[model samples]
Target: MNPRILLWLAVGLVVWAVIPFVVPRYIADLLVFTGIYTVAGLGIGLLLGHCGIVNLAQATFYGLGAYASAYCTVMMGLPSVVGFLVGAVISMALAYVIGRPILRLTGYFLALGTLALSAIASALFFEWDWLTGGTLGIGGIPKLDLFGFLLDRPSRYYFFVWIVAFACMAVARNLVDSRTGLMLRAMRDSSTAAAALSIDLQALRTKVFVVCALFGSLAGSLFAHHASFVSTQSFTVDRSISFLLIPVIGGATSIPGIVVGALFVTFLPELLSKLGDIHQILFGLALVAVVVLMPEGLVGAFGKLRARLAKRGGGNG
Candidate 1:
């Protein structure tokens, strides 16, 4: 909404558009992966940050997108575009059904309940050999073709992912600026106080959950097509936690923070993998530092700092 943000966003989009012409393919691939996962992370952040819902079923929904897309492509022989919509619908429905009951619970109890959903999904992926190809995994998935155009390249996927990420960010930014966002903040602070005024608690939370889920399913569809191969491993416990950490590390207050967080969570491993076994330790330690020192998240802390600086400048003026 601000001109400063619009300017930066335009510049970033331009850079993404031109990246393939200048950047190496491998680096572009890395960025592409980061962008796709960032879309998923952004969805998680939106739900958790605004709606005050901690979701463990993100990977489950994501896997559904991937699997749905796969089924569409392989079984129905349809293009990924159609598959993407179908998969997204499935995710939205599942989230809605689960959210109706689960959203009422708060704190760790809600968390455990959602975590169960994820566990069940992962189990199905592993056990349903007939549909998902079981532990052996599904391979030889054809490249994603849109309108008969092959989007099998990394840079292509990057552009695609960037578009989706930008769209999700736009939605989130709008929500933050709108009255609905204020309502979510109210509920986050105290549901009793919110309900005292007669807020439609169930509908409000359901809307947010479905919106967040749309992003998750879209991210999953992109992931499926990008990898062209997926399995139970793609929706593992580690991945769920990793996706959750992105917003936490980045600060959940704004989309920019989540983007930065996604960058780190998506890639810090290869950056530290020269030490091989020590990479996980370093990653864990870094996360711990983020938790203990920057608990409000990086973006959130920056917002506070900016407000303080503005106050100081105002006094000086």
Candidate 2:
């Protein structure tokens, strides 16, 4: 691990450790949702940012995990942990099945394929009344009880969610630093060159797609348990777009950037809610401004600024 990363981790640990004690209950609850969204954002970052795969159907996988957990626990009388596992498995299987063919397409075609899939999934969520409860969705999901300890309170659940989020971040960071991650970057930079190097593009793409879906699955499972509810409204194409925007706005290649983007996106609506009917317009404008001004993302822009400032400081000295 890099010394700077270690230092940042230590500092982050301290901050996370202190947040529950100092933050208000409502704020803690918001943070918990932020953590969930952060995990989903990480998945999007892995696919879109790292692998250069534009997946517009990420929310379908997320919804699958939520619905799977809801069905297993609420309908089948399973334990929370079992439901979580079942949800993750379902997401992985579905991702594998769909990714094999869909990942072959690139650019706008790929985006359109995912968009169509997400639309179909959203329609299914509405039509599958018996399983998904139509528009009302599944309710009464049991709280997560780990080793007989129930995470019933917002503060408690906040810690739990953030722990999972950080664990996911650590895993993503490790993968990004590994050879597989290097291969992914190579594929992203130039699929032709990667193919020339004998890299199995299909296999690698499938693996990363499944891995990305699993992150969304884990997050959805946590969300189902945390909110004690699962609704079709929560998992729509719009939600997928939001997930896609997080990594792009934050800095797709940087794990910390995803987290920051998630936090920003999660709270931006709430902060803008007071702006009456023009909030969405303002939000859209802000997004356009960010993309135009900072093509490499906010984190990358900051890093570049810092490097320039450091060089200037050295020159002055």
On lDDT, the candidate that comes out on top is: 2
**lDDT at residue 143 of model 1 (Cα atoms):** 80
- Candidate 1 at residue 255, lDDT? 85
Top candidate, metric TM-score:
2
lDDT of each: 0.82, 0.89
Candidate 2, residue 158: the lDDT equals 87
lDDT, candidate 1, 242-273, per-residue tens: 88888888977678888888888877876888
Give a tens-digit lDDT track for model 2, residues 218-294.
88898898889888998899998998898889999999899878887888777787889999988888888878899
Candidate 2 backbone clash number = 0
- TM of each candidate vs. truth: 0.91, 0.95
How good is model 1 by TM-score?
0.91
Error of 1 at 201 (Å): 1.8
Regions more than 4 Å wrong, model 2: 1-9
lDDT of 2: 0.89
Lowest lDDT block of 10, candidate 2: 264-273
